[model samples]
Target: MPHGDPPVLGLVAGQGQFPALVAAGAKAQGWGVAAVGFAENTTSGLAAETDWFQWLKLGQLGKLVAFFRTHGVRQVVFAGAINKPRALDIRPDFRAARLLWNLRSKSDNTLLTAVAGELRREGMEVVSALRFVPELQTPAGQLTKRGLSRREQQDLEYGWPIAKAIGRMDIGQCVVVREQMVVAVEGLEGTNAMLKRAGDLGGRGGMAIKIFKPGQEEAIDQPSVGLSTVETMLEAGLTSLVVEAHTSLFFDRDASVALANRHGLCLYGRSDGQDGGD
Candidate 1:
C-alpha cells in the first residue's frame, strides 16, 4: 500500500514502548511497516510510525496472516510484552485453535515457534527485532557513570548463574541480588515489577541481573532492556543493573545511561560465560 520503494515489514505488536521502538527503527531504514496492535495494549500512536496499521484481537490468526499477505510483507518481527492474563480472553480461530491443540507445551517459546513456522510456511520470514536495531545490543563495560563496585560485582558474579539457571528452567531471565543473596526472582510479573519487588524486599538499592536462556532460539526471543528499565530501577531505589553483554539487547542506551547516571545506578554489561563462577 505504500507508494515508495520500500521493503514491507509486518510488526506483531504487544504492550509498552517496545513495539513503537521497533516500528520507528524499521521505518528509519525505509521499510514500509504494517503494525498490528492489540486492543487494550499497544499505543495507537504507533499507527503514525508505520506505513499501515490495524488492531486485531489476540486470537485473530486469520486476520494477522491476511494483513501480512495484503501488505506484501516479507519480514515479520514481534515486539513488546503481551499481558498473558488478558490473552485468556482470546477467541482463537480454527487455525490458531488447531495449532494450539497440536502443541503439547504452551510456553512462550512453543507458541512463538509455532507462529513462526506458520509465517514461514506463508513465505514470511520472522526475524528478530535486533535485525535493524543494532544499537540495542548490550555493550560490554560500565554503561553508566557509576561503575559496578567490587561488592556489586561479586553479587553479579553470583547472580548471573542463578539467573541463567532460572532462564534454563523457562522461569524468567532476571534476578535481583544484594550481598550475593537473591532478593527477587522474576517470574510472570516481568522485569519492572520484579525490580520493584526486589527493592521492597531488599530495602534501598540492589543489583538486577538479566540473562538469555542457555539455549534460547535466536530469532524468536532475545532478552532486552531499555530506558523504561532504568526508570523502574530508579523508582525501586535500585543502584545497579547487570545484563548479559552481547547476548542481551539494551535499547536507547544513551538515554538509559544518562538516566542511570542521574540516579547513581551502576549499569554493567558483562558476558555471562566469562564471569568467573563460584
Candidate 2:
C-alpha cells in the first residue's frame, strides 16, 4: 500500500443494481473499481461508475482475467445475477472450457468455486462485496411496517427448511409456499418467474422463502432481494418474503420496505434457530 494509491477491486458485473451498488460502496471507501461487465446482462449505467470497464460475452473467461490484471485489480467480487438460460448460449474459450471440463458437476456452487479457484490461481482473490458494503446484508427481524400474520409465519416456518434443502442441492434459492403446501420452487426460471407461477397455481397470500445454499461460497452468488423483487412479489400476489438473515443481500432496503409496506406485504429476515415475525 502506497500513499494516494487505493486498493483496486475488479467487479464481475451481471444484471440489476447490485453491481452499481458495489461500485458505489468501493468508491466511498476510496478504492478503485474496475469492472468486467457481461454484454446485455449487465446494467449499462455501471460503465460510468467504474474506473475502467470492459464488456465481454459470458464465456470470455480469459478476457475477463486479462482485463482485470491489466487494470491492476488483485481482488474481485462477483455481483448481480446472470440469467441462467442465456448462459447456455455462451461460447467458452479454451480456459473456460478446460475449467468446465475439470468440474465434477456443473451445479452453481461447483462452477463458481472453480471460477474463483481460477481467479485465485491468476493472483486475484475473490472477496465478498459485503466486505465493502456491509449494509447490504439483510439484518435479522421484520423489515416492513406490518408484521407477519400467524398464517404467514406458519408458511415461512414450513417453507424455510424446504428452501434450504433445495439450496443445498444447488437447485434454487427460493420456494413459494401457501397453507404449508409448496406452490413453486425456483428453478432456472428465477425467483420472479417462480412467484408468477405460484400466483397462477395457488393465487394470493403465498410466502416466498429465499436462502443461501448450504456449503456455498458466500463471497459470490448470495441470494438477493431488491425493489424489483418487491415489485414482482406484488404483481404475483405474494403476501410475505423470508430471506436468510446475514447471508442474503437486501438492496434498496428502505425503498423495498416502503413498497412492501404500501402493499401490505411482510418481509422478514430469519436466521437459524430464530422464529420469524415482528
- Worst ten-residue run, lDDT, model 2? 269-278
lDDT of 1 by residue, 21-83 (tens): 888889898888998999888888888888899998887888899989998999999887777
TM-score of 1: 0.91
Candidate 2, position 238, lDDT: 90
Clashing pairs in 2: none
Q: Which stretches in model 2 have alpha-carbon errors above 4 Å?
A: 1-4
Query: Which window of 10 residues has the lowest lDDT sum in candidate 1?
Result: 269-278
Each candidate's TM vs. the true structure?
Answer: 0.91, 0.95
Candidate 2 local lDDT, 65-87, one digit each (tens): 89888878889999988889988
